[model samples]
Target: MNNDHDSSLPEGLDLRALSAFVDGELPPVERAAIEAQLAQQPQAAARVAAWRAQKTALQVLCGASLRNERQAHNESSGGVGQRDVDEPAFIVVRRPTPWWQRVGLAACWLAAGAGLALALGPLAPRLTGGAWNGLGGQPPSFAERADIAYAVYTPERRHPVEVAASEEEHLINWLSKRLNRPLSVPSLQEYGYSLVGGRLLPGEAGPAAQFMYENTSGARLTLYITGISRDETAFRLFRDGNRRTFYWINDRMGYALSGPIAEGKLRAIAIEVCSALGGKPESWQ
Candidate 1:
């Protein structure tokens, strides 16, 4: 029985555990195994010792900075525990200070890549949201995002989206929870289109919601959505090839329906959806 992972190792430690061990972040059982392995292999043990020293050095350096800061305030005449008289200073919050500081695309890519690298770690937090950086300093329009999703996903033979419509109840409930809004997949079955499925996509506004439909002839369509800002009010459409993407934002939420069903057929389907959606008050109001 080979319990070993595929990587260079000391006696019995694996790469992942080795990494955790190096960081002093491993669980006790893992730490024990890594230590046992270290003792058995002189070269590996030396490497692990060097990593431990580096980790210790970093902690000490940061600790020294904090100590120096505390010492600079020569106002404390009381004992060590007397510091409780004052509240701890708040750490500076680092919100993205606007991306267009884009000095260069390469630098932008590096920073974005650094963000993505954090996503690979086991301790990585779940991704919550993002904002698009448009060219020339304008914010990227959600409509443009809809158009892109339309072009890339509508022509697909497989994997058009996630959370296919087979799980209708689950899809609706799950997406509704994520968007913090109730969602209805308007029925277009009366107009030759039927529910095909849907996908859960990530978005800047929230969990991007997507639903798909298909007509009897196999033509496909999709609805994409996420909450948006007030400035995004209004309905719009974009086209490329046989595909069309129609998107709109209201006070409550936003939606985009895209597909390759010919214009006339597509319009009819849209009308059905909109009617089921309580008619387009903004466009025809």
Candidate 2:
């Protein structure tokens, strides 16, 4: 075969071994032998040297591309800018907005909003009863929050309560300390419901507690208690779909009993819980 079209590697050195030797990936013995071959064979030495030069050039090209991309990204994000080094850094320019123009813009926006609302008619969203109402710094109502908390944790199986009911005393003590009040667990064993455990949670106004209870049929009820801004003696019953929530505020503390039970049955349980908390459920309106 012609030398240029040999199509075969040098003796004792395959293409893979030569490539590995050029990449410094060979064992010490193999590397020494490859080095000796390169020293003795001009063709093998030239091939290895060409590979090293190509690797260096590739690294330089890739580094330049990455730097260029980064510079472009910084410029687009307003992070990097080209300016004369001797130029003054700070310059002030005034552009005053006329009151009449501002009023005209406001009128245009108002008219567009009104037209949109009229076009949507009955489909328009309610500004008042929304999840986020722009009230004067008022938090969500107790019933809404208790309903959400109940929905979130009632389906839990293994890790329902942060502190299990077996450690009832510790759970109560820990929550009480976190809430800055002497907390008590109302016994529901009379209604076939016993404490499963309780966990400390963040309430709209302050720290809160969710005391979970389960009956013989695996039915769960959560008694959500938190500090309130004012004392409320009257009870209010709120129903959201299948969930019945009986809530009230007493002695600056808000109490809500949430469960999937009927309104009447949950109310009865709420009465017992309210009485335990030094409140009269009969006075609920």
Candidate 3:
């Protein structure tokens, strides 16, 4: 409708562009083309419908919270407070958020809402496409992203780590400062894996660390660590596609040990890692 066709777009537009169209980021011509496609494509139509439903849910939740805060502010001032005369009763005036903050807010709603799986199912694959693709909204959680990082960097012939294992002390210090937490490299020597190196990665919450270890057979594993939202001790074994990972949250930090090793072996390594991090197997159980 807007143009004859989008030559750059494939027969079907990508998930990222479709998501942008939903968020009103696409040009009017592109928007019209996507709308036309959605009308003919049932699956694409469903995806757009789901995203709209999620957006409406977030607006409702955000509005309700703002209203509650306004009421509380009024009560605190004895029901007499200065207000924006021109602002509508339903609108709340506050500091403006950047574009990324708006995307992050959508992420918050997805996390807290009951439609998490429904919302994420359609967007998970696009997240692994690259770092820049998922800025329109929350792609997947940190765990899955960490798995993608592993897949991307583990096969390198060289430059596997930004800081080599020989610089262990500096590596520990640097990562701890970036993460704002005391970090210790676990000894995997007993399990036939020696530390090759560690590197810094971008995480959902903030900066993250990835420590790599390799055994005599050239098999490698990584310990991924980052800050979590809350302080809690929880452990679970998760398989993202083919990558087997044992992820846990300890105190304020979250860690995941990932590899293609056997379940028992990975579990053993995870336990040793937990013990080194001042936790026990039963505690995680």
Please write out the lDDT profile of model 1 over residues 71-148, one tens digit for every residue.
655447453523433545344456874655755776889999877765553333333222211222232355566667
Clashing residue pairs, backbone N/CA/C < 3 A, model 2: none
lDDT of 3 by residue, 69-128 (tens): 776889898996555454434635588789999999898897777466566655765765
Q: Each model's C-alpha lDDT? A: 0.66, 0.80, 0.79
* Deviation (Å) of 30 in candidate 2: 86
TM-score of 1: 0.47
TM-score of each: 0.47, 0.52, 0.52
Separate clash counts for every candidate: 2, 0, 0
Question: Which pairs in model 1 have colliding backbones?
Answer: 162-199, 165-197
If both were scored by lDDT, which would come out higher, candidate 2 or candidate 3?
Answer: 2
Which residue segments of model 2 deviate by more than 4 Å? 1-140
lDDT of 2 at 94: 70
Q: What is the full ranking by lDDT, best candidate first? A: 2, 3, 1
